[model samples]
Target: MAVDKVFDAIVVGAGHNGLAAAVELASRGWKVCVLEAKSTAGGAVNTQELTLPGFRHDVCAMNLSSFAGSPFYARHKDALARHGLAFVPAEHCFASVFRDQSWLGVSADLDTTVQRIRAVSEKDAHAWQAMLADFQIKAPHLFAVLGAPMPSWKLARSAWRSWRELGKEGVAELLQLLLATPRDFLDRHFESESLKAMMAAWGLHVDFAPDTAGGALFPYLESMANQAFGMVIGQGGADTIITAMTGLLQELGGQLQLDAPVCRIEQDKGHAKAVVLADGRRLQARKAIIANLNPQLVFGRLLDAQSVPAKYQKKVDEFRPGLGTMMLHLALDSLPDWTAGAELQRFAYVHLAPDLAMMSRVYAEAASGLLPAEPVLVVGQPTALDPGRAPQGSHVLWVQVRVLPARVCGDALGRIAAGDWSQIKQDYAQRVLDVLEAYAPGLRGKILASLVMSPQDLEQFNPSLIGGDNLSGSHHLDQNFFFRPVASYSRYNTPVKGLYLCGASTWPGAGTGAGSGFMLATMLAA
Candidate 1:
């Protein structure tokens, strides 16, 4: 019951961010120890055979475009790559199919993509070219702001540089892009509904809907970035980054303690000193304490009441989690035969949202505690990109139905009864399959086996996915940027001395970038 094990730093939750922190600290000879609640390292990025044997499914996260573009990966690329982490890029990043059997998507080749857009509107094709050109000019400054820590001169300097580069009119356009809705931005540039709908779906991946303010930037970034640099995913599963990061951490002499859920943060003299494990063991930290958790979990549950101020507690209480998501992992006999034709098979993501209005209705209905009639479906056929996932002839489908209420009260279409997720998850999953079969006929028949994780199941799998929100917290205007997690702690430094936050809950929020952790490591090392 009594042990004395001291470390230079203690990192909580062995997610990408937590592992990153451990690796960086150990690289600096900090003698770090990482504590993860789960049995394995990867948090949402874990890979497993959810449906059947040999059918590897990414439980939560699948895309690695953000990770591949991250400065964290950039700094440790060779080391990570040498650890057997391979990335397979998509030829076609994404496609959105319509009820009329027409589809629109973006590919690695600009000419091929332009031709696709030209088929709908020639003017929009030129607009795509112009947008990429502008991105080339503004990307350095834009990404600098996104990646830089908030409440610092680093972000300010980047913004100033952008202002000088863009001048008056260009600055106004940039502001409009940042402030305007996805509908406004796309309608301003492109004339086709498919082009607009195709790109706007990415916003749903975050907190934004098509009409949500502060949504324009996500669509622009995902589309333009994919065109500039192809979308990359782990070769076999999304957990490849986790494997590589764990290897690096262990190689640097850091210890990863699995299945060790930290019950409380032990503080003394207004500084976080150690974490008490669930098994009544206390792991002491001599230097710093890093929490890879949602602010609510860290403050509301783990830390002492007096550890944070009243105002900060109120902010944490007000920390809104985005909409819940339901995951459908399927081991299919073959990939869904999209009615839009064979070309659609090359893409990583095929969105079933027909237009902006449908996406709007889904967000509205879900927020009102009702599952949408036509839920926006992100049908991911990962096996298309990597043929090594399943049996030689078999394939796997990673389907995510967006904008479901965390606690479902009723279905918008009035099909499923309002009840606990345990009772209705299967029915809800069937609803998702209904929509998928509509877009991609014969899809339902191809399923050899399937597994559905409800919103509650998601929360149970990882407490960070509060109310099944994969982004950790909402990415709305008031809660984003300098206001992320909260205004006072936006710089990753908490109110408590030597306590740092690093996770999806922090800035450069969400996805598998490992940005926040890497940034903290860089800051603390300096």
Candidate 2:
């Protein structure tokens, strides 16, 4: 812990990936130190009392859906358990209510889920079974892919193994599934509008259109499958995961410094030597410097432009953040009632896109930098499941609407500069409240406190979420895979020697911080 002591590695950014990387390195006997700009860890996986006293709300990322399937969590569960992390499975995963008052609830039990679907259409219920079966067969390999780095030969080997196990026809079916859009995929199998909408809404969680090419929708469906496998809430909310990771790192002699904003990564002989902090302090390292920051931030701002490769620089400029989202955290006096089941006290997570056409319109309007007439809303009432989050009869609601543009343009920026953005936010919040009221009556009056975070606030809180995009970069085919961040640097290791990338901006774009940290650890271990 000496001020001048050199560590084996220095991890920039205390996000999940940064914590995971530090833990992995420390576990391997490498002396590590993590630098965080924020006083607390858990970048997006943080919980706070943003509203009234006694109301604990998860500011971002409510579900451990991705964490459930993470090999990192599986391997480190014992260590994590000591830090107070636990999981609670919901009876129902999600409920999507249509404009017409029809609803579809995805249950933890596949049979129950099928029955729920059958209420809408028997044929669709059967199709739902087939989809689950197919996913069950393919999920293991898919999960493996998600845990490792992209274009990995190891992953390719697993794919080959799955191919052999599934045979040619099954392989063909998998290929077809990957290529088909969610809209077409659902239409071919389901007849019920509500059932199709529910599935499509789940697929659109990443804020991508169901019709986007290269079938990006598969990952969202895969996310649901992963969640259903081992859906458990962490002990003290998502921050516990970060706290556990930090504890693990500390146990292995890894060091961490909070409120240390890294201004630059100093290099020597084409390799990272140390990080320059904003306070003008230089902390040197001997082995590697891992950046858990967004690729755009790492390359575009933190590293000296003269030292970066021209090609990489171009890609850094070109890298596009995925759609940003508006997060509304509400502290309510009571839980909202659902029409599907009166017994439902909490919505584990709710999907609000009613149908494919509605979803398409939402995407279209968002793409144009305008709020949708009916935005796709994802809601989570963690207090319903974890009463400890609030006082008796109180609840906390986390609502998010994926938006196209992270920043306001000409007129909108001007409006914000002129204090009109507050009005805009109020207007938008009302729209969301109106939707909530229609689906769950008496929701508005129960609000004792609320906080609205614009896209600008999100970027300010986490620079990695550039343009307020939580996904790092768009998951579009052009920006994914070998093309991610840039073509040659998609594997977490960057062009700068001993400097790496590990955030949502890397491969597997966003939602679920499982892949980035695990993959970076694997690469470093190798």
Task: Tell me the number of clashing residue pairs for each predicted model.
Answer: 0, 7
Q: Which candidate should be chosen as best, given TM-score against the real structure?
A: 1
Residue 481 in candidate 2 has what lDDT?
A: 62
lDDT (Cα, 0-100) at 432 in candidate 2: 79
Clashes counted in candidate 1 amount to 0
Task: Identify the runs in model 1 with alpha carbons over 4 angstroms from their true place.
Answer: 1-3
**How do the predictions measure up, each by TM-score?**
0.98, 0.94
Error of 1 at 7 (Å): 1.1
497: Cα error in model 2, Å: 0.9
Mind giving the per-residue lDDT tens digits that candidate 1 earns over 116-211? 999999999999999999898888877887889987788788778878888878778878888889998998888888899899999999978888
